[model samples]
Target chain A: MGRALSLAVIFFLVLLPLGVGGSTLFQLPVFSQELVQELLWQSWLQSAFVSFTFTVGLILAVCYLSLWLGQRITAGLSSSRIAPLLAVPHAALAVGLMVLLSPSGWLVRLVHSLFELFPSPPAHWWIADKSLVTMAVVLVIKEVPFLLLMIAAQRDQLPIQRWQTQAQSMGYSVRRCWWLVVVPALLPRLKFPLFAIAIYTLSVVDIALMVGPNTPPLIAPRVHEASLRFSDLASLEAWLGQWLMIVLGAMLFVVVAINQTVYRRFGLDAIGRPNGHSAQRICSGFGSQLLLWLCGLAVLALIVQSVAGTWFYPALWPQQWSLGRWINEWPYAWPLLQNSLWLAVVSAAIGVAGALLVLERQRSQRKKALAWLPLLLLLIPQLPIVLGWQRALGQDAGWLWLLWSHAAFTFPYAYLVLHGAYISFPSRWLYQAQSLGHSPFNAWLHVLLPQLRGSVALAFAVGVAVSIAQYLPTLWLAGVSYPTVTTETVSLAAGGDWRMASVYALLQALIPVVLLVWASRQGNQQRWKSKHVRN
Target chain B: MLEIKHLTISKQQHVFLSVESLQVAGGSVLTLMGPSGSGKSTLLKWLLGEPLPDFQIAGELWLNGKQRDQLPIHARKIGLLHQQGDLFPHLRVLDNLLFALPRKDPRRHQAALEALEAMQLSDKANAWPHQLSGGEQARVALMRALLAQPEALLLDEPFSSLDTALRGTVREWVFAQLKQRDISVMLVTHDKEDAPGTIISMKELTHA
Candidate 1:
């Protein structure tokens, strides 16, 4: 039974999408040479440049921050702050960033209020509302927490603390030890996550739609717009663009793989060797704290925008603050909230269950040959595979397909979250329980599950966040009949209705944040109870 | 009594250890001393009815003159103690004892409390496994195992993790508790001092 469930999950979630996508590649209509060249030079190159910049910037930022944070803060405190940022939806985060970085946004207003530098909103601001820099900045900010979490998960398996101690004993500074010893070890483990981040940055559509440049928008948004037009030429163009994305994704994976290997081989020996001089310690205590504060300020900006009245340029605070927008928008927002909530809850539950089934089946097997197979969903860019699902299900598919799409994406994350803990758990505990007279099933129920409750809860919370952040699947699969908060937020934000968009974006960000808080609290309570049982 | 007959433990059809017959009468221990990788722990796992997928074994286990090799681990009515005590960390000291008692016993809570009292741990009924000192954890583990009322028990270097002073104390206390229950025991250890009676070296047990 476990084998069959595992096979079914692999088939439906991993194989089916890839198969559909492969078929879609073959069915693309031929276009003119000039058009291909135009897209190649115009859309694809621009998107690639932005994606390349974003991926490189994100890698540097996350590595530096992970090292800096690892040196200063305890893992528990850092994770407590960083993990909640993962719950914020990508589109909502982009909207919040827009509220902060736009010409007439908060930063400019603060500057004007203090130094009177900007009499009015700067006409030509450095970080424009729709520019490549803004898009890359937003992507970097959002992805740093995720990669940091991935590194944290791998830290236990590596002897990072012992290595740090050994290196520091040899007269290396803490920062030098991390760079010379820790980062080299970590880069190899971070390969797949970096690939996923690269694919995501290259193929993200909603964030690009919100903040990316307009004249020849990013490739993902271009494909999205073309696909939505519902014309034969547009459909062909979308498929062609998707084909291009697949090629780019494969190329990017190779580049990242080669980068990891090269770094591990020569970079470690040459640059990572300890020099005679002790590296000067830079005061870098505030990296993760700064990120947490930025996330907080983003949420705060959203809150203020949602309730503001006459919030003009160069004004630090709104002239008036009222709950009128909430009152007016609540009627339209109600169903969207319900849709987003139910979808996130049901999909996250299914995703977690699917992950458990696969892990259980893997445990029973002697050889875990394809242990990383499920995570292929993450390595593949969402655009092509989701486009494949759209093609297979047709434009008029039902709500179940939408839910399935959400679970398909959420399952990999849930699996990634649960895999390490599930695999490392001592099977001897179950044996001990059985030796004490409980049946195998009873032993598992009483022993293994309780021990893994924290991991399970966190996986479920991550699944919920993944489901809440899904914009493409919800929009492409369900359309207007089942509009979700994410879909509504992106559309409203793109349509220049910041006030109404903030209302939906806040709702979008709130569900996952609340679930994450509740899950972490549940985990903390279990730990506290086990450690502090009374006499 | 706990007995093994015609026991052959081999890997890939190469017989490494063969025992014609061995027995431990009730209220006594048969100690097998060997270095690491000498199949001492593997023999104990087989006695405990753990599935050893990497080995080929042919043996008949008899507990009190009944052939018990076909029984599952739970039904074999055998207990095991490892070096680290392996107490259930999620359960408090009292609940760990209670988990070993029969579920249908109406006074199971009182039985558990009495067991703790016998170990001079009545005041620590609610303490977590991590809160206990090493000697206390070893004592609780022994008490928990004996409370399960197993037909026999296997000790896999159970006292090896303690300090030299605590080791002798815990070992003596464990043997006293088992002898008081009149339970059969097979102890595998590398330390000759850990064996109290009838020591069998691995070289004597292995086939040429």
Candidate 2:
């Protein structure tokens, strides 16, 4: 299973882009060329700054918030709940939020229906009112859980208790220890994921297209518009490339500046006795609970909207509920769902297998030449590399190319999650297995794998979540010709019809939500089962 | 003065440490010695900090004439050296020592260099901790704690990871260095011979 998955991943990574090239590359290159070449250095530079500032600001805010939230969550709740919450798709979340915010949305529709007593919808635009608020909110909701999960994972490895105690003994307060010691250590490890989130937020097309300012939408959506519209493909590609370069440069500058500020403020020692907060009530337990409750509410809202038959606003619940949308969409949804499932499953399976191989190889090798390889996918922004790979491959058709594209995205997360679990496995168990004369594979299967079921399940679940959330790869490599739920949802959302769009958006989120729910239970069950087995 | 009174610690419902009383004044040293699993380390952890909550601890601890029982670890103005030289892996030896200095200390780099010179390790200032010999890393860890100018120091088998010959030398150097600073020292060890001051044997720990 491992070998086959590994081979599949390698093959896909190498061949898929090449496979997709025939149609998009040779047959329609001229049509797409103008879209690809439109580079306005001034506008590109301006948006780059916008994206850089927004991204940096967002990451720092999230990092600070993570410091606070991580402490509260660990002190209060179990990490088991985190996975299910994190498993929700970014696109579906943006769509749901757009629903709540758009004037014609559930929010405004209700206002018009209840307050004005209007029999018909209002002509005025309400929520996404030419502001970045909707986009920013969507990004925060989508990104925080990921940052939190990464921190939780990192915390599992750190000697948090011991260090906290030592810091306290040294006259550092709990808040200080967290700020000075924990945050610094945790932040650096988290930088990659945080960067990924920042880049994704800046470059997100689907979400931005759904709710971001339209007339002159964000750079990503504009690029998409340019390509699909065919009036200016070359200009779009140059604009994208130049915007990428500028954004990357600006991001680097801001990241450095913030890093310096953090270093100067916190100093060399990450652990310090923190000064107590005079105003600690920014978000209380009640507020966080509310935030979590709202996140739950968001999921419920989407799930409910996915099933709702037409109902006007002001009602607390949808007046009608049916699976007619699911029924009508099944034939279309089936092939797409199958494509999505196979994509997620294949990508996840391959990613896990690839990660394991690299880890095992690293374990056996005396020299650590490419220890940073797995981190590349995790840390580097996907926009440039994926685009470059697409250009390099020249395009082809086949599952091979599609699978490869997904692997490029999935493998890093798989490596990070699985590598953590692999390293955390007690050496004594392996020693015992060796002493028992068990071969490495048998030892892994019988001793290590069984013990690592929780971590493995968690890693696999995370891998699935990441693959499911992929918008770029599914669109880019699949040529937007194949209508995966993500592609369909994004396209439908582009057309500006909330009711029908919500249906596709919710459908896109369904499998991953189910997978996440299952993964969470499976993780807990595996953890429980392992304990029983050991006992 | 450093005082720990009627301190008790339990892990998974099993009592690890139940010390009745222990005290060390300015320029004094207290050695806590017991067999492995007899709560010697647990007592050191209680005095310094226990990062995990797997254990329940009941205690009153005073440091430098202040009631520090409720003070968090960093605010307690205490420093610790563990069995492994837990130097920040990413930092050079000088920076590792420099990291322990107070934020407002203008001469942190100079102080760290001086500390390295005192340890006869000035040449290794730019070297990573892993690049240093085990004995050298031990000296750096010792200097890092001392340079912080901690009011008190706890040594949880700081020299335990060394070879026998190196262990004796590292222990002698460590205790001497702490003594030179007039810092109160609390040492926890399985080996009684390493104790330099009054020993607290928890073999007869009472039910507090």
Candidate 3:
């Protein structure tokens, strides 16, 4: 029975989407010459450039920041600081970045208030919306925390401190030791996360819509636009766009693979035989802190803008603060908030439960072959698979399809979060429980579950975060029938209502942050209470 | 008596350990000493009814005249103690003991407290597992195992984790408790001193 459930979960979560998407690829109509030319030369080229740049920037930043934090602070503290940034959805972060980096945004207001560089908002800002540079910046900022988190998770498996100590004892400098001994080991382990990051950057839709180039937007946004229209030509374009993303993803994988090989062959040797003078520092702890603070400031800008009254350009502070916008928006916002809450909660619950079933089956079989199966859902480009689901299921979007789509995305994250801890849990503990006269199921429920409460809670919280941040799935599967916080935020921001968008975006970001805090606190409290149990 | 007949353990078609027949009377210890990875712990796991997918084994187990080979781990009514004791970390010392007792018994709590008193751990009942010293944890683990009222007990290097100074005392106490309960015992350890009676080495049991 357990085996059957696990196989069913695998079929539904991993294989079914891939199968549908693959079949859709086979059935795609031939693309028109004009559409093909426009996509290849215009959108695809720009997307490739942006995605490559973003992936490289994200990799460099995450590596430098991870090494710096590993040297300066405990992993625990750094994760706590970076987690809120991760909790903020891509669209919300893009909207916040728009608030901060736009011509009339907070940064301009602050600079104008200080230097009087302009009498009013500047006409040309370096980080302008609807541009490639701004899109890349937002993608990098939004993705750095995720890559850092992936690296941090692998920190325990490597003997980093011992390696550093050994290298330093052999007379290598601290920085040299990190570059030589530590980074090589870490980069290999980070391969899957790098691929996931690369794929996400290549095909992200919501952030692109909010901040990407407008003249010929990136391929993902093009696909998204085409997918929304009902015309046959548009549907063919969308199908072809899906194939384009797959092609781009394959190219990125090959490039990353070649990069890995070349680095292993020559890059390590080049670094090992460095010139007498060490290189100047490329990253500092201060810079990483600044990035985090920038995210915080973006969130702060959202808060201030959401409640601001008659705040004009060149004014650092709002002319007035009022709760009137919130009060007025609440009536319209209440049901969306309720839908978002229940959808996130229910989807997260289903994701975690499904993950547990898969993990239990893996445990019973004593194999880890299925471990990477779930993560394939994460590594593959989500746009095409979700589009395929939309095509296969037709327009009969209901609560069931909405929840299923959300869980389809959330399940991978839940599995990723729980796989390591669950697999490595001591079997002897459960065996001992069984020997104490509890049946297998009872032993698991009474003994193993309690021991795994902290991890399970964390997985559940991450599932909630993933569900709340879902934009494309919620939009494509359910459309406006279920207006989630994510969909509403994106639409509002795109419609040029920063105040209403901020309100929705803030709620989208807050639910995940709140869930994360509550989960971690619950874990800590369980630990503390267990130690001080009363007589 | 706890008896085994025609016990042969193998992996991938090559026999590693075989015992033609063996028996231990109630209140007695049958010691099997072997180096690590010589099927000492494997035999104990098989006896406990754990599924060792990598190995093939044929054996008949009888406890107190009943053929117990087909029984599940819980139904086998056998207790196992390991090197680390493995007291459930989420439960307090007392709660760990109480967990082994039947849930519907009205006096189970009292029974757990008395067991703690017997091990001189009454004052440490409410403490977490990590808060207790190694010796105290071993005592609690033994008491928890015995509280389940098993017809037989298996010890897999249960005293190896304790310091040399604490080892003799804990070993003596464990033997005394098993004797008092008159439970049939099979103990596997590398140290010969852990055995109180006859010791069977792995070389004697292996046919291949």
Candidate 4:
């Protein structure tokens, strides 16, 4: 199983690229002579490498620093207690950040309105500039919460009180106990999550497209545009761009591996709380409050931006608000909304069912492949891999193919959600029913299904969120002929039309909200039913 | 040294647990008895002043002649142990003992050693909490609490989960040590066998 899964991965990376290259090489008009040179210059692959290195390094440093500073102030932070940040989709966040930080962004306007001290931005502003700093900033803000959540989840499982009280009793403050005892223990467990964040940073497409440099964007986005939009398989340059991204992705794997080896050898993250930013320290201390503020502010801006029919910079609020556009938008917007919801539901159902089946059966050495594949899927540059499939399949057979690809991605996440709960579920209850002469299937249906319904509901909601947030697959696989909330939002956002982007963002945010609310209600019902049974 | 006056903990205008008045002078044990779901744990939580947010608490609690209800948790001069004994499962028994004292105290290690020796758990000093038997966990939890030198300790069925053979030995030792230290204690239990001195049933308290 391991060998087969590994071969499958290798085939996509190696053979598929060669296949695309060969096809382009043989094609008449699509293969341009200067494609490689154009890629080196226009694609900004070198600049992207520099920018990626800066963003990944700074974000990793900030993440570790935030954890240390948070541990210093208090040990109260835990992953399960994080704010609604979990539910706020990634594309939604990037759009929000764009609205806040753009040259004509609300923050710039707000400052201008209040103080009038700062000069207006030049025609060519730094937000999404060639430097890519704005993208870096947004990436840090988004990834910080994720790292905090991941660390806190594992940390909570450790014996916090025993360690805290033991250290505090010996004349140490709460901060000391957390730093000296708790942090060292948490570091080893945090290795994979941090790696996930790094790969995520490297391979991220949506955020980079929204706030990153366009003339020369992140490698992932470059692959996305070339293969998906250009649609000229004869374009050897596009295929060449895809190949370059795959190499960069390969380099990231090496970087993470070497970092791991060096870490284990020298124990670099083993000690010392380096002083991070004081403001960031306060933000970490406030914990959920900070997350809520960022989310709330972004949401409020999106709402405002959506409604303002005609509004200029340096205005605190819209001068005029109109429902006319909203009414006009609904006809065009309704279909996208319906498609996104139905697709999410269909994909989530299929994804969760597949997860349940995979988890239920016992596998031998194949389980190791299962473990590696999900993280591999997570770390990989998604667009490059999909370009191979699109190149292979030739422009998306139908919506069913889109649904299938979305489920394939969504399966890992849904499986992760159900896995911990499924494994820990009491086998005794199922066994006891079977011993009483009920068939195995009946016992499972009667005992396990009801018990697992809550997890299934939650997993289903997560699967939907993953689907709704998808940008490239829906755009590339379904083709622009079929639109989802994410595709509509990004396209409008890229066009510099805040009003239309805001409407799509609201609808995008709405789908997840509806699913989560329903999931939560299902959870409550399950609890109430269990209690009623006991009574 | 521990007093709970006019304590009535209510949830959404529905009373869950209430006690008009109660006091345990120094060197005494007040055993609180009740069946499951009868709010025995609720009463202990209320007395410790960290009751669930869902419940409304109205009361005055004084420990060692000071009003403690308004004090922060660490400064309440009160200690708590639950059914599982709640030993810092990650720490060794010795480390757990040392956790009771501030690090600056030069005698913290020695004090921990002495305390373990007195409890006749000297051999298990380096053992993790999970390595110990239920009886040993209870003893360690109790010793850890006492070492903090709390004016009062609220034990919520601390000994009920222990094996029958080890219960009597640990229970007798616990009562004797609290009396020797003059630390007031309230032990909430369903067992009649655990009555150290005066036993006050929770049902009786609610009626009063």
Query: What is residue B3's positional error in candidate 2, in angstroms?
Result: 52
Give me the TM-scores of chain B across the candidates: 0.97, 0.90, 0.96, 0.94
| Proportion of true inter-chain contacts also present in candidate 1 | 0.57
Q: Candidate 1, which segments miss by more than 4 Å at Cα?
A: A1-75, A169-174, A269-284, A366-370, A525-535, B12-16, B102-104
Q: In candidate 1 chain B, where is summed lDDT lowest over 10 consecutive residues?
A: B199-208
lDDT rank order: 1, 3, 4, 2
Clashes of each: 0, 54, 0, 8
> Per-residue CA lDDT of candidate 2, range A1-44, in tens?
65685567445543343233334544444445443334445455
Q: Per-residue lDDT of A406-524 in model 4, one digit per residue for the tens?
A: 88777866766565556555443443233223355764665677666766776787788888988777876775667888888888776766678888888898877666656656555
Model 4 stretches astray by more than 4 angstroms: A1-48, A58-62, A65-83, A118-131, A165-192, A228-234, A258-270, A273-283, A361-370, A419-455, A517-535, B1-208
- Using Cα atoms, each model's DockQ against the true complex is 0.50, 0.01, 0.46, 0.01
Q: In angstroms, how far off is A82's CA in candidate 2?
A: 1.6
Report per-candidate TM-score of chain A alone.
0.90, 0.82, 0.87, 0.81
Off by over 4 Å in 3: A1-75, A112-119, A122-124, A158-185, A256-260, A270-288, A526-535
Residue A526, model 3, lDDT: 56
Order of models, best TM-score first: 1, 3, 4, 2
TM-score of each: 0.91, 0.63, 0.90, 0.63
